[model samples]
Target chain A: MDTVISAEDLTKKFGDFTAVDRISFEVFQGEIFGFLGANGAGKTTAMKMLTGLLRPTSGQAQVAGFDVYRQPELIKQHIGYMSQRFSLYEDLTVRENIEFYGGIYGLTFKEIRRKIPQLLHELGLLEVERQLVKSLPLGWKQRLAFSIALIHEPRIVFLDEPTGGVDPITRRQFWETIYQSAAMGVTIFVTTHYMDEAEYCHRVSMMAQGKIAALGPPKQLKQAFQAQSMDEIFLSIARGAK
Target chain B: MRTIFFILRKEFRQIFRHRVMLPMIFLMPIIQLLILSNAADFEVRNIYLHVVDRDLSPASRRLIGQFAASRHFVLTQTSFSAELGFRDLEANDADLVLEIPADFEKKLLRENEASLHLNVNAINATKAGLGQAYASAIIRDFNNNLRMEWLDMPDRQNPGRFDITHSFWFNPDLNYKAFMVPGILVMLVTLVGLFLAGINVVKEKEIGTIEQINVTPIHKSQFIVGKLLPFWIIANIELGMGLAFGKLVFHIPIAGSLWVVFGFAAIYLLVVLGMGLLISTVTETQQQSMFIAYFVLVVFIMMSGLFTPIESMPGWAQKVTWFNPIAYFVDVMRMVLLKGSGWYEIRQHVYAMLAMALAINTLAVLNYRKVGA
Candidate 1:
């Protein structure tokens, strides 16, 4: 696999506090890379620095063949970001949101018109295309947001807690969407607090207190930690963090 | 340009879709223009008067009759003591007290000159000043009449008093509403412009949509222009409606060409809306943006001289009005609507606003960050 994201001792500090400490990692193309951390474990911070949404205090990172700091605009053009807060204009109708996001990604009107029916048909959202996003259920909205983020069809897609607050059945279905994108040779960088979801990744890096405490395949990590499941592995690591 | 168009389309859709916002955007300004214009008048009338006549002679009685006859003053009471007249003034029953001294007719007949004292309520200073001028004029007219009748001076055909004939130019009737409607129209446009532009980007930030946009390849300048353009267009439309209401309802005359008024409004919106965008860039949430926008607007409106003349403010405050964008617009509207000032007459205000627009917009765009939240 080709290495798509390369980081060397990435760090970010806010005034006196360090949000993301000196941590380094690499992500290969067409692989599901899981970034697992607690609520304040700096997972989002590290992801921001890698995605060029934040400037690193020290060290350097290259994303999609562009430097994070010097070529942030270039990096932005090539990546799709679905933020933790579920970014979609709730007042806008489903079709309008698609058109807007598609437009912002430099998609032509013809291209967007061609993609809309296909996208809606694929997501089973064709029936409610004109309905406001605020009226949609939580599961459908999340699914639509994810699809909209991928509408640009960039090489890499970053999902920040994309399945948060959804039902377990919907979460399982959401994983299927992720697997489908990965099968299409799109690199996936996902951050989640769920241990079971972490098992779905090809490789996982666990962060604690602004630093990565462990990095390996989920199976190997569980085996190395002498834990029966990913949950125990995370619990044991979290215990050691204290 | 395409990106800006996309953003602009999205903004317009959102604004039109909001139920509460749609009504507020139109009705609030209309209501304010029709209703508040009436309440904001500064014309003083129906002054209450209490007269204390110490002399029972015909001269003093005739003098009292002159004040009673004038339409501006209403003789509310008659008092024998100056103390009681002062008490009525302090109690808010009377605005002025006319006190004639004892032996006033005897002094006027023998010595040929007599003086009367006037005690005026000065709490509302402008009202007091106008009332005093009316009283003094009536007294002067009375003195002239007495000189012509009692003195029998055919040789001195002209009285020695310097007859200063007052001529009011524009707004000759001094209709306060005419002076206020134009300034109020400017306020209506600004309220729409500043508050809308101020909260727009910050609302996106609060909702986490701004983070999504920040990671896009869209340029900051494109975003700033896109954000400001929608509100700019809406505010101008609001200004037009307000001006129409001012004309039809309040009967305000538009002296200068309508194009000149709109031209000034367009440039002035750039400055005010740019400041609003600047506020949004630094603020993280809509609430913060509202507070900062309101604080700046209060200072702006007070210094704008919409209700009070900027010249009447102290030196430092007047100097500060030179930087206020609202002040320039208010001045332009008044000069054009009341004085029929053309573009050449308002060229200085236009140039000042252009410089302000450029400086404020450049700084706002520079301060907007694509990264680091």
Candidate 2:
């Protein structure tokens, strides 16, 4: 498998405090890679570094085969980012949001017009395309945000706690969209607090205090720890830290 | 460029969706322009006067008659003594007191140099000054007629030869409304641009939408440009409406080219919008941004030489106004609309506005953060 993202000794600091310590990891193409951590455990900092939104204190990172430091714009062009706070314009309709994001990615009007219906249908948002985003349900808004992020057909999609505060049924539906994207050869890099969601990932990395304490496929990690499920394994590691 | 267009479209949508803000943004300025123009006139009218004529002579009566004949002043009451006139003034019933001493006609005939004491209320100095000038002119004319009758010479020293032809060059009548309408227009546009733009991005921060945009591939400069463009357009539209009202309703002449006024307005809008962006960048909440913007705008408007001449201010205050962009635009607008000044006459103000625009915009762009700090 081709490595889509590579980070070596990545660190980020604000003032004298380090947020993301010397961390290294790799994400391959077409796999659902899960990033799990407690709040303020440096998951956001690491994701920011990989997405080229932030500069690392002293590290080397490459995304989509482009250097994060010297080629951030190139990396930006190839990856999609959906933030924890849904980024869609609340005052605009779904179609307008799609066109806006597509335009920002340098997509032509003809291309955007052709892709709008198919994209809306795929996300099950065709009926509400004319409604303002603010009027939509939170679950629907999250789904629409994800769809807008991928409107440019980016190679790797980053979902930063995309399903936080969403109901289980909606989260399952959201994961189904992610699965569909992954099946279409799009790599998914997601962060979540839910251990059940981690089970769906091809591999999972649990961060503890700015360092990756555990990294393996969910099944392998469960067997290695002799746990019944990913949830039990996460509980054992969290208790060990305490 | 396409990104900027999208951002601008979204901004317009947001502005339209909010019901209360929409009327304030579009309708308030027009209403103020209509109502305040009439209230702001500097030409004093229906000025109440109290006359204390002790002489009881025909000449004294004629002098009082002259005051009554003038359209600007009205002889509202006749007092028996100066004390009564003072009482009238204290009661706010009279603005001026004309005191005629006893034996005034006899003294004038004998000495040809008899004087009349005139007391004027000096509070609200502008009205006081105008009243004094009008009363002095009437008294002088009455004296001239008395001199003519006493001398009995048809061709005595010619008053025409000594006349000072003081002509108001641009505004021939010195219409105060003509001057104020343009100035108030500048105030309205600057207030809207600075306050609205100031709170816009900060409101997003308070609501947590800023974080979403920060992570997008959109460049920082692009975002800043997009945010300010809608406000810039709105300000210009307001300017156009103000100019139209000035010409049609007030009959204030557009002495200079309309295009010249638009060009200066466009450059000045950038400076004001940059101030808004800078305020948004520093503030975290909408209310804080509004308060800060209001404070800065109050200082700018007062110091902009709109209500009062900058030259009349103390030297230090005048020096401070040199840094105010609104001062330059107000001067430019008045010069263009009233004085009929061309580009050559207004080049200095134009250059000053451009420089302020460039400096503030560069500072705003530099201070704007694309990612969370």
Among these predictions, the greatest lDDT belongs to 1
Tens digit per residue, CA lDDT, model 1, B1-373:
8989999999999999889887788899999888889888776678899999999889988988999988889999988999999999999999999998988888888887899899999999988999999999888888777867788765356656465678777788787889999998888889889999999989998999998998889888888888999999999999889888889998898888899999999999998888898999899988999999999988898889998888899999999998999999999998999999999999999999999999998898888888884
In model 2, what is the error at residue B219, expressed in angstroms?
Answer: 3.3
Q: Lowest summed-lDDT stretch of 10 residues in model 2 chain B?
A: B153-162
Q: Lowest summed lDDT over 10 consecutive residues: which window, candidate 2 chain A?
A: A233-242
lDDT of 1 by residue, A1-242 (tens): 79899888898999999988899999999999999988788999999988888989998899999999899999999999998796999999999999999998999999999999999999999999999999999999999999988998999999999999988999999999999999999999999888889999999999998999999998899889888888887787788778
| TM-score of each model, in listed order | 0.96, 0.88
Runs in model 1 deviating more than 4 A are: B153-156
lDDT of 2 by residue, B71-158 (tens): 9898899977999999988888889999999979989988888878888888768878999999999999998788788867454466
Please state every model's RMSD to the true fold in angstroms.
1.8, 3.3
RMSD of 1: 1.8
Alpha carbon lDDT at B198, candidate 1? 93
